[model samples]
Target: MTPPDLSVYRLVFRLGDALIRSGASSATTTKALLAVCTRAGLKHPSVSVTLGQLMVSDQPDDGSPPRTRFHEIEPGALDIRWRTRAEEITEHYLLGDVGLEEALEEIEDQVNQKPSHQWWKLVVGYGVLGTGFGLILGGQPLTAIGGALTSMVISFIFRILGHLGAPGIFGYAAGGFVAVLAATALNTAFSLDQVAVCIVAAIAARLAGIASYGAVQDAITGWYISATGRMMEVATSTAGLVAGVAAGIGAVRLLWGPSVQLIETVEADTTHWTASILGAMFVAAGFTLASGGWAVRLLALTGLGGATELVYLFLLEVGTTPFLSITVSTAITGAACVLISRPINLSSNAIMMVSLMPLFPGMLIYQGLLGSLFGLEDSGATLLEALITAFCLSVGGVLGQYLFSEGLWLARRRQFHHTHPGESFSKVMPEEYNSRDIMLPVFSKPFNGSEARPAGRTPKGRPTADA
Candidate 1:
């Protein structure tokens, strides 16, 4: 194998380091490396990447070059080293020969480029999720449909905001709140069902949390470099959603007063095949819109989410305890996300945000707020339940990631053994290959063309080398 060019290797290394710091997954980092190598026109770039492995090749070997290989380490095993490398890359890439301003401008330009046609998928995803939310909240068909529509429109608006460089978290939160308010107002004005309105609003709010880059878990793990900037962009676009919903709700409350009843529970017959198909379509549409342009992928994701919800509903029908059902369902969804995300390039954040929307305790928050406003005693209980639900969701996500990472490590270990039966896998370097044994090659001129002088030495009292 030919030695890689040092300069090009360094460039790739730097970018990889940055990606690592930004909290990218091994798969994402590997893809980014491959992309950089491709952009640099490297030969056989695909073969050069081993997911989660950090290889430093200062100069290539004359014999068969050290092949890229995979080894699994505990998450955060090389965090410090990776962070330093990332910082170096960031410094050189953004602030070296090219001015920082120029580097930033270039980054912005890259971000603005439409890499895929996935916008329709996002619209559908958001819409479908909204419809499901309506069903869960016991909304009527029209209210559910209206809520889904409202959510889709808000999602499109946020996409535009994202293109304009809005922060993601704020954008999502704001979007969600606004969608809720809007749905609430429309339902109230037309004597529509509150259940349906709330469901749609919830779906719209959750869509704000979707991200194409697949960095959701990274954000939770303090992989801020990777997660922070992107999340901020999402937050900003979502703000509009929250604002719109809040406005609608505020307007409704002002006209109707706090005493108005939103939903009356009539014993309606359970929906069957037709209703299920319609519900599924709504979910698919919501996810499609939320996914931006990745409609096919979004459809698959919605199906998964819908299946999860259906299973939970089934368990409920069988008289399984609500708490147990929720716990089991949450675990299943979280684990499924961990297992399937990498193969398809979807981010766990998008999955978690959308899949969990049906269970986010929005009703609790609303009821709590209403109780507090009206000086009701049950407000405290509602607030506590809401907090606990959020906690459970967060905990479920973390547990899923940890389990997945460990599973990857085990799989890699098995592969390594199968490939090299006699070789012992050592986490530490062999004595001969340790950093201390590696010597810096000397570059010096010969003394009078007889013998080369060592670097940093001279015949005279004065030193030949600067330090």
Candidate 2:
């Protein structure tokens, strides 16, 4: 095999690592790299992802031969800042002002850029994020406080364990266990009525790592290996979380009289609208900080999160099943998010990562686990229902994306943008803009460059179809 273009190889590897590390899907990474290579005047490239590795192969348009390079996918936290910046770089490159070298350097810088916000600030953001969810769930001040504090502690512990080189799942389980144990104590000690809601809300933020939307998107796009791997990781992490929450409850029950009711309760709006709205805003804000997202993005997500919850509530009141409610509401959010991606200057995927935070299956899953552990009569049925709810949320989110992709509005947007040139312009990248398409997309920019021809694998003058 001939040696590949080191520059193209480096850029592709860097971009893929950053995207995957930030929770972008394998398909998204492939799309971005293909787009980048195309714009950079390199030949068509093929990209593949496994659990902790990625391979990129470049071929001559002539089909003479192909050369490939492999890179490892490191475990890292979701930093929306890098995600946004990476998207911006892709957009910038597509714009064509920056050369291949400069664009590659800038992307590298984004990958290496240190977090601008302090760890304490992140802690506060997560606390506020949990508090907002608690409020939305009708948690009183005590429950809100408990949820906020517990979330902060758990997030910190998750980080510490990551630093200690623990498998990512260990941190998730630890956080879940710790959060529930603390929330349970608060509920018992203070007699808070919304303990279940509060605990679920607090843990919701971390559950984003499960990458449900990405998995579905990849599967639909024919990346089954990537999808299966993602699903397995998500399932393992979710099980760990559920186990932790259940373990906490079991331990707590041993110490005290049934800490939380764990019995079925009717869904009702016990909290005022003002409280719920505030909760939504804080949850969005907190999500932004914890994920290293920007202020502008936070504002959009706040409104989106609130609207989604209101839709969810309305659906519930209208007698929709919880699963259906989550699905329909997420679909709506997904469509709106795609339309707003340009204006918000955030990837739809990034927005969805947290916009639907309120719609996470954490609460439902917790309830189901509680039922089984406590030996409720309907435990089996409840568990099945919870699984179905998760299936709905993931499928609905992707359905919304597919609907948008095939819609006239998105078509017009794509047409206008592709035809228009340089308006100080940046765009969230495709489905990777993409339904990432966590489902977040990197930005795409256009520039032109010619690479020197190599042995049998000469550069194809024009971009070809992606692999």
Candidate 3:
């Protein structure tokens, strides 16, 4: 039988890369691929895959003649094929597993082949995410609109930077800092609510760093790939945010006296239920539009955010410190995330971003900065508190993730024991596939009254099945 087309294999590889990057479970990724294949009118497209077996070829180029080969298939049987040059195979063995840099290079090569307009899809998606963030931060409608627009523009600029082969970290930081500074200045000059404007800016900036899928997958499978990427992304974005805020504040300090307060005090709203619900809806709409997510999914995410905020408000009303409130709320959010793992396709990064926004201690940070500009002695204490609050937020989020994952593991063990009576889970749980044995068949082919044939080889001196 003719081997499956190379284009199909390429498509699978691309989809797999995206699924893996997005932190989707293998089972979910497989199911989604099946659905896509079905939609595309493909036949017998169901394929079994072992994780890590689908790695990008890392063989080096050497001056030699290229080689290509085809595999054979029995009538009505599946055909699998692979291609490699001898030099590439040698290099692949020499290099061992390919690193992220190599993987990204491969991805870039493939992406470059597609129409340029495809990049806009990513921009639009991130823009929506930013807008949702703005609405959640209690920005006005216009602020949300502006933030989304600005995020899209920045995304395009970042794309250009990428095309120019700029360092990703520098590009992301520069883009994010510029966006935030611009938004902050616009808000301050026009007497717009700086807190709301900051929220919108922060959301836009933070979207550029969101890593929900990676964090979740890392938490689930003990993989560091997702975890490290997430940490780096968060750290860089935070640096950008700090830099932007500093720049904007510095400009204000220079023009006005250092003693002038950039922020004006406003009365806190006492009405809760109506405003909260409306705000939640606004957040939902913004996110739905930004992420290109389903309305139901957006609503669910908004509900979660609103509910968490209400809990924090309650804790605050009872004299809880902002630090403690954020800590507890984040822990709760993390626990919920672990419990509702599959249903909440929302990334932990995304959820964490939204949940933390309302209680970000931005006001405290601003106050501390203001005090510092005026050289207030007590400013040291305020700044310390501000730093502590930020520390607590990070700690709470990490603690939540750890506790929830551990709890899930324990629960799974308990369930296993309950089902197996005296049996231990260690014995019952299947061992993870090792790289050496992943492609080895799990079941022997059914006896066909013929000797087993090597993959892609036709039995010699026998009547061909096709004949």
Candidate 2 regions with alpha-carbon error over 4 angstroms: 1-4, 60-65, 75-77, 116-118, 188-198, 208-210, 257-274, 317-323, 408-467
Residue-pair clashes per prediction, in order, are 67, 27, 1
Candidate 2, 224-283: lDDT as tens digits: 787787777777777777777777667767776674553453232423767766777788
lDDT of 3: 0.45
Q: Give the TM-score of candidate 2.
A: 0.81
The 10 consecutive residues of candidate 2 with the worst lDDT sum are 445-454
Q: Would you list the C-alpha lDDT of every candidate in the order shown?
A: 0.47, 0.67, 0.45
The whole-model C-alpha lDDT of candidate 1 against the native structure comes to 0.47
Candidate topping TM-score = 2
Query: Which one wins by lDDT: 2 or 3?
Result: 2
Candidate 1 matches the true fold with a TM-score of: 0.56
RMSD of each: 14.3, 6.4, 13.4
Residue-pair clash count for candidate 1: 67
Error of 3 at 128 (Å): 5.9
lDDT of 3 by residue, 311-376 (tens): 766777789877798788767865664444335434343445444444444444544554565565
Report the Cα lDDT for residue 197, model 3. Answer: 50
TM-score on alpha carbons, each prediction:
0.56, 0.81, 0.52
